[model samples]
Target: MTTNAIVTTPAIQRLATARAAVVKAAAAAQAAHDAHSNLLVKLADAQARADESLSDFRSGKIDEATSALRKAIADADAKDLQKMINDSAENLAQLNDASNGAMLAEANAKVAELYEQRVEEGSRLEAIISEIESKLLDAVVERYRVQAEIDPDSLKWMKIYKPSPALDELVRRGRVPGF
Candidate 1:
């Protein structure tokens, strides 16, 4: 019986372990993201139900029961947001912990394989996060632009105007009039 030395290396074992760990972590993160999406849907549904209750109450279709249910739904939505935030926080912590372990495994594993997997997964998640951030920024900018077109005071509140210190100095120096 001939034993192949190439198949028994400690480095090979570590590389296999690292690959498994990376796959597991990605699966966990995907699951958490799915859960977050589900919670968001639930929160939206609760909000919609609350709105319906308010409309019914306003229309006199129901009594205090509608207001009570609306309040309960609002509370549930708030709790759902908190739960989503907590879940994200916990998942991030777990990812951080797993990453640290994976780094340790890299020392014992095939460097190229470890590095390649890490970079691929990191870049994939980074792309997802970047897309989400861009969407959020676009929405905020759109909202601000619309508000500016409607009411300039919203922009003023957002401090998108000239610096306060410079304006203050100008006002103090009588270069500008105080309104």
Candidate 2:
């Protein structure tokens, strides 16, 4: 109804929409952070086991056993170590891929949400313009109704500003010229 209200409605709507989008993006980032954290724990455990096995071999623990049995356990432990490394490598790769995917998805979602906001802002601005136009029409009608009581010049009131076609185009595109 009022000029300020008409001008601010679009801004308020845009702010609400942007806030929701930010919350969603933050939640996705947090999930990715937790997944990486879990992978780090697994990696640390694997590293500890590998280090302990290497220390035993370096300290002559293997030399104390009969050569055949020593060779067997050493081979088995080597295989175990290799398997652990392979598993860790695979897990790390998977973790990297997952985190990368999450980041990409979050970026894409945020971009999509921002575009949606642009559309919403454009629509809200259109509504505000419509409201202003309607209010101006009402004022004009009231002035005409009081034609006999008031001088035509004395009834002059503020006029509505025309919609900015360029601004509408810019907002729709979400950027300035050449972008």
Candidate 3:
């Protein structure tokens, strides 16, 4: 083979490898973005569910037995008794003594518990998504570093060959010949 062909072979191989790395990094970034989007959707859905549950509890739409069960469990494990009482049965009773205040309290407590759990889950998912985003960024930076290492001159060429937006528009409009 000619000297030019011999030299070009390794260059071509390096270019292909760099291109593949870029494609892989792009795919990974896209997947991470998709996961982040899904987590946002989940967070919204959890919030909506929490709101609906709270509304149902307040409106006496939840069953009495279920509400009582929830209250008993939550109250037994509660750290802030005054807050729990204020947020639960006592609060409801104060609002309307004739209403099923105890049941409503239990239901409200349960709704709050579920809402907190969902928020925690959303927080964990957000952290994971953040980690994935960081990893994607690192991967891209590493790929660029590797490419620069393999072909230092390419960076100089890129700096010199910056595209002109006006020229690009003219080319697209068939007013300038495109190369």
Q: In terms of lDDT, which candidate is strongest?
A: 1
Residues 1-179 of candidate 2: C-alpha lDDT, one tens digit per residue: 65654543444555555556556655655665565565556556555555555666677664434444555565666566666666666666665665566566556656766677799889999999889878977876775667626665554433323335665576586655555
Per-residue lDDT over 1-179 for candidate 3, one digit per residue giving the tens place of the 0 to 100 score: 65654433433454455555555555555555555555445545545555555556778989666555555554443434334434544433433432334345445555665666688789999999789768966776676677689887666644434346765576477565455
Global CA lDDT computed for model 2: 0.61
Which pairs of residues have clashing backbones in candidate 2? none
What value of lDDT does candidate 3 attain over all alpha carbons? 0.56
Error of 2 at 150 (Å): 3.2
Clashes of each: 0, 0, 0
Whichever of 1 and 3 has more TM-score, that candidate is: 1
Candidate 1 residue runs with Cα over 4 Å from true position: 1-6, 96-108, 112-179
- In order, candidate lDDTs are 0.73, 0.61, 0.56
TM-score of each: 0.47, 0.45, 0.32
TM-score, candidate 1, is 0.47
Q: What is the TM-score (0 to 1) of candidate 3?
A: 0.32
List, residue by residue over 11-112, the lDDT tens digit for candidate 1: 467788887887787677677778777777777777777778878888898898868777687878868787876777788678767766775776557775
RMSD versus native structure for model 2 = 10.5
